[model samples]
Target: MDLNLESLGFTKEELQERVIARICTQLLDGVGYDEDDNEFTTASQFHRQMRTSIKEKIEATINAIAEREVLPNVASYIENLTLQETNRWGEKTGEKVTFIEYLTRRAEAYMQEKVNFDGKSKEENGNGYSWSGTQTRITHLVHQHLHYSIENAMKDAMKIANSAIATGIQETVKTKLAEISTTLKVGVTSK
Candidate 1:
C-alpha cells in the first residue's frame, strides 16, 4: 500500500528521521565499557568513558545495518528524502548515495581524519596515555537521529493539524468536478 506519511500522522521526513535516531542511539549505547576497580574516576575520566562508549555504539549500529534485509528499502527511502530535501534547499545535494554508503564513508573518514590525537591516535588515547579527538562524527550521527526523531514526532502532530485541510480540499474539488460533469451532460442533452 502507498502510505502517505501525512495521513498517518507523520511526514515522510519525520518518520525516516525517527527511525534513524532510534537506530543510531541503540547502536552507540552498544559500545559502552565498564570501569575497573581502583581506577581513578575523575570528571575527565567519565567524559572520556562516555565518548568511547558512544563511538562504539555508532560503529556497531551502522555496521549492523548492512546485514539487514530492510537495508535496501531503507537506503532507497533515505536517498529519495535526501534528494527531496536537496531540492527544497535549492542546491544540488550532489551525487546520489545510499544511507549505508553514507554511513560507511563517514565512518571511514572519521577514523582516518577526525579520530586523531595530539600526542597519539584514538587507540593510544583510549589506553590512558593522552587526550584524543572527540568522536564528533559519532556524536553527529546521534544528533542527526535526534533531529529526525523530532521531525517524525512533529509530522505525527501535523496529521491532526491538516485533517480539516485535507477533507476540505477533497470535498471542494469533488464538488467542482461534479458540477462541471453535470453541466456537460446537460449541454449534450440539449444538442
Candidate 2:
C-alpha cells in the first residue's frame, strides 16, 4: 500500500530519527556481554577523536541505504504520480517521460546544470539554475537520518547510563547508607 507521509501527521523526518538507536540496539542484541549486569549497566564508551570518522561512516551507510534501497522505491512511487498527473493532463505518452530511468537522468541533468546570468537573452544564456545544487540538499536530506540516528543513539546511551546509575545507587550505595533520598525509578510508578 502507498503511504503518504504528510497525510500521516508526520514527515519521513519524524520516522528518520530513532534509526540509530534502533539499529544500535538491534546490533547490540545477542552481543556477548556480562550476564549479571543488565544491558544498561555495562556500557561501552566511544572516543571523542573518532567522532568525525564514525559520523562519516554512518553518513556513508545512510547514503548507501538511501540510494540503493530507498531511492528506487521512491522513484517508482514518483513515477506513478508522474504518470497519473500526465494522464490527468492527457498529454502525449512521449512528451512527459518520468519513468524511473528517464526521470533519474532528467533529474541528474537538472541537478548538475549551471546557469550563466551574464547573457543577453535565453538563447545566449547557459542552461543552469543558480539554485540547482542537489548534491548538498539531497545529501543533507539523506544524511539527516544519520544525524538523527546519532542523536537517538546518544539519548539511548544516556538513558542506559541513568538506569545503571539509579540501580547502582539503590543496590550498592543505598544499601550501605541507612537512609537514602534518591528517587529510583525501580518499580516505581507515577501516581
Candidate 3:
C-alpha cells in the first residue's frame, strides 16, 4: 500500500522541499513569481528611506538659499544710509540719533510710502516699490539681480542634489549587489 513517488519524477517529500526552497528564495530576493509565473518586485526599505531623505534635503536646501541670499541684502540696505544735511538741520540740536536706527526708520517709511513707476504703493504691489526716473531704473536693476541670484541658487541646489542622489544610489546598489554576490558564493561553496 506504499506510494511509489519516484515514478512521478520527484518524490512527494522532494516536491515539498522544492516549494519551500522557492519561497525562501523569493523572500530573500524581495520578489515573487505570480500565478502567471511573472516576477513581481516589492519596494525595499532602503528605497523608502531614500525618498524621505531626499524630500527633507530639498526643503532644507530651499530654506538655506533664501536665508543666505535674500535676508542679508535687505538688512544691509537699511543700515547704510547717511542723513542728508537738510534732515540733519531739521532735527532738534541736542537730540542724539543712532544712524543705523535712523536709517532703518527712514527706509521703512520710504518703503511704506513710495510708489512705483506705475503709481502703486509698495504694499499695494506686494512689497515691491517703484521709484521714479533714475531711481526707478536703479531699483529695477537691483530687483532683477536679486531675483536672478535667488533663482540661480535654487536651480544650483536642485542640480547638486539630483547629482548627489544619483551617485549615492548607484554606489549603494553596487555595494549591495557585491555583498549579495559574495554571500551567495560563500553559501554555495560551504554547501
TM-score of each: 0.22, 0.29, 0.26
Clashes of 2: 1
lDDT of 2 by residue, 124-182 (tens): 34443443333433454446777889999999999999999999888886566544545
Q: TM-score order of candidates, best first?
A: 2, 3, 1
The better-scoring model by lDDT among 1 and 2 is: 1
Best by TM-score: 2
Most lDDT-accurate candidate: 3
Q: After superposition, which runs of candidate 1 have C-alpha atoms over 4 Å from their true positions? A: 1-145, 157-165, 185-191
Per-residue C-alpha lDDT of model 3 across residues 73-185, encoded as one tens digit per residue: 87665566445444555854444445786767767665545456654554556754443332443465567788899999999999999999999999999999999988884
Off by over 4 Å in 3: 1-113, 116-141, 185-191
Which stretches in model 2 have alpha-carbon errors above 4 Å? 1-101, 109-135, 178-191
Worst lDDT 10-window in candidate 3: 128-137
lDDT at position 46, candidate 3: 57
**Could you tell me how far off, in angstroms, the CA of residue 79 lies in candidate 3 after the best superposition?**
39
Q: Is candidate 1 or candidate 3 better by TM-score?
A: 3
Give the whole-model CA lDDT for all candidates, comma-separated: 0.65, 0.58, 0.69
Better of 2 and 3 by TM-score: 2
Query: By how many angstroms RMSD does model 1 differ from the true structure?
Result: 35.7
Q: Comparing candidate 1 with candidate 3, which one achieves the higher lDDT?
A: 3
